[model samples]
Target: MFAKLPFRTGTTSSAIWQGFAGSVMLLLGSLGVGWLASSSVLIRTPLFILARTTPAAVICATVLLCLGALLMFRAWLRLSQHLSGWNDDAGPVLRKALILWVAPMMLTLPLFSRDAYAYIGQGRLMQQDLDPYTNGISALNNYFLLGPDTLWTEAPTPYGPLWLWLEHLAVLIPANSPEIALIPFRLASLAGVVLLAIYVPKLAARHGFNPHRALWLAVLNPVTLMNFIASVHNDSLMMGLVVAGLYYASTKRAVVGILFVTASIAIKPITLIALPFVGLLWAGSRAGWVRKFALWAATLGISMAVMGAMGAVNGLGFGWLAALQTPGTIWHWYAPVGIGSVSLGSLVDWLGGDGTPIADGIQKVAQVISILIVMALAFVKIRLGPSGGLGADLPEPQRYSHAVMRRMAWAFTAVVLLAPMIQPWYVVWLLAFFATTGIKDGWPLRTVFYLSAFFILIALTDQLSVFPWISMEVVRSIAVVVAVMGLLYLTLWDKKTSELFKRNKPDQHAFAVKS
Candidate 1:
């Protein structure tokens, strides 16, 4: 257990015991999700000993969650008040372990327990040449014969072309048991992990942050591993592709970025948000108009072709053209934007979450707003290329320039915010891009990252039981939301961001530099 713990020092017995305790928590949090997924007496016995009712589960969840929140808050205050300094090395390390520790709590993802099975049942439909997008579980597969779980029997498929195609493909793996269904999907989620490992450090090193810190932040995020690996969400793969695209874009490989982001959009169209940043990169180039135009056009064309082929092969075709029609069909919190604005809009009626005339209208309005905002930023960047040569957020003195790396971080953030839904795994975008940013900017980046991870695990604690209460889930969700936002401010949005846009005018630069 201590082996996994990065910090520990003691003589003899105390050190040994502490190490053992740490190991146990880590293992239990990661693999112990079996409590909800499996009904084996072995798994249930201990939890039963701990507490049986929904209240007990809720209580346990509440206590740990609150404690975790306070711990994180303490860390934040320490950093913000200048009582302590993280430096480059220590800042990211603390964030890594905290984030990774959150993974096990996601075991509840399965134990909360409905979505994965619906994916199975839906995949079974695709096996029979049925369109899952338009159909429910009953269309291709019968419900009464399974383990009596609603996720398996009833939840509708809500994912898009790439996920549905993969879900359909996963069905062919020949499952002898329910766990086998989880096998391929879990393995598939590893694509994000691999990508994080391969690119985060490289991207970080390129941008002047410690590559090691960046690598740990992305590759080792618990929510990412838990949701994608244990929970089997596809966001990991989508995020991996998105970040890979960003990594390529940073290298001036706009074509590669386009192809990768296109592939991501096929998985989830929200990845398309990165296009503006990609466009920004194109505009940043010294290339002539024809060359820049050709690069942009070629990438867009190739991306569209890939999406079309993907849809065609999966029997989805251009059905996604109807995406605008089903505006409210997805969950709001499936992305960071959703989480950020959870309280801004009407409390979405879950049943009415399906697109209807009113919700559709509102969603369209919101979508348009997001577009206007993104497009406006990109448009401003175009002028920079033509007239200013370069904008700020450039490391030295720009008013607001993201550079290649900061651009990646901000681009990924926008991608998640504008996503159709917000899921826990969606944090991978943050995890991925955090690695690719410049120096820490005196923000407690690691501490915030750790805080977010703790709340995620606390949320998962409820999944340890059969009927985890909505009240507790709600409480946990709120705590997580607070933790996430607090962290966001500390880590990503702490400083004066306008500097990212352009260099201060010379007159102002003189004052600002000295100020």
Candidate 2:
């Protein structure tokens, strides 16, 4: 089915052109969003003139931003196709595309979430010798100047101690200068992107898959670029380290893998679930099942000890564990648990009973069920035996690595699905790992592609701070029309229709070659 795509014949040069165009559009979109949502400190003086705060101006900026995001998604698809089978070295082409894709984001303010600013404020708290886990960013005094959302000002950080330890570097920058401090975190996120770029293909190569395609699916993905680089989220860091650790463990360096994955857990605890999969990769099929399970258990124990010691060293201890429920407070329809909670809560209220407790109980139960499902998948993967590559007769090591990758992918997917709260960026953790497992031209691929486009559009539209000048109904109508038209062109009319109209030429050598 993938063989019929028109972009399958596209060249690297054409793909790069599309990438450049996408970046330009993304820049325009980002600028629009900045004008509408960012504090004046984050916006350049000229941008204010270009993107006035009035309703019409905000609407126009929204259109421009949406158009840019859509164009970038289109270019990314073309680039992925170009990288898949084209024999010419993709390194230079990919690097150029990466630069175009990521450079504009560095200059943009945080887009989807105020988490980065929260990171800054938390760092300030730590710098003042206050325990960030016990106290909120407001403890820093005059922290509102940093533009952190009021929501998190009094809310304790939900991030792990290591993340806080690393974020403390922001305190070295002058006080009350949010924009300047923002640069360091953005750079750190960019570094994570670089790590993914460096390691994704290497991991793919070890398993006999096309490295370029893996890079395209994992690093060049629109969802990844938007959340990891554009919004400058720390998930990028955790994900990169997780992938690199998995690669090392698959290649027979279990210690190195353990270290990398441990760091990833410290960034955010979700990747901690990946340790068992790494152990499976390390043990391979030659080891007894008991030994494999033991290795997995050992890895987890060591990882926990390392993480605990690090937490102690920072003096933050395990306070983040208590704050794990923080995300549940920010409920939205996008989160599965949130949707259930809202619906159940509403129903209970209609039944003349207290609703909040019942809804919270339902959410907790759903989360626990998701965790159990993940554990079940992990055990099943271990017992399923070798599962990567094509056919029977592949090396045991490669096969084992492939199986581990699939299991790790499933574990991350479970985390995203079951978490009390989820955001579009959470998709990145699953997508990055799944990409390395060699998924090409299947339902899984299609799912990621469509989900990426849908969620990114949703995130862009929802994150905008609406103005009173234009009725939201008008904005919604216009956005819907533009989105439908853009999606139709990109997915159906642009190339699919052209292919349908072109006449099929007869095969010149089919009959003669038979003789």
TM-scores, all models, native as reference: 0.64, 0.87
The TM-score of candidate 2 is 0.87
| Candidate 2, lDDT over the whole model | 0.72
lDDT of 2 by residue, 443-505 (tens): 556666778877776766666544455566766566667766787677667773223222444
Instruction: After superposing candidate 1 on the true structure, give the runs of residues whose Cα lies further than 4 Å from its correct spot.
Output: 1-114, 144-162, 279-284, 288-290, 321-327, 330-362, 382-421, 439-458, 461-465, 468-515
Candidate whose TM-score is highest: 2
lDDT of 1 by residue, 1-515 (tens): 00121222222223223223332343343232222334224334666435434454545444443343333333333322221222333334434443443334333324323456556666777888877666667764344332324433433454667777777777787655445565555655666666666676656555444554455445544454445554556677777787788667766687888877887787667676676566556445344666656666666777788888887777677666555333245545434444434433444554445334454455556567666765554443333333343233233312122354455455455544665564455566666666566434323453444544453544454343334433545545644665555445544554632122223322211011110
Full-model lDDT for every candidate: 0.51, 0.72
Best model per lDDT:
2
Instruction: Give the range of the ten consecutive residues with the poorest summed lDDT in model 1.
Output: 506-515
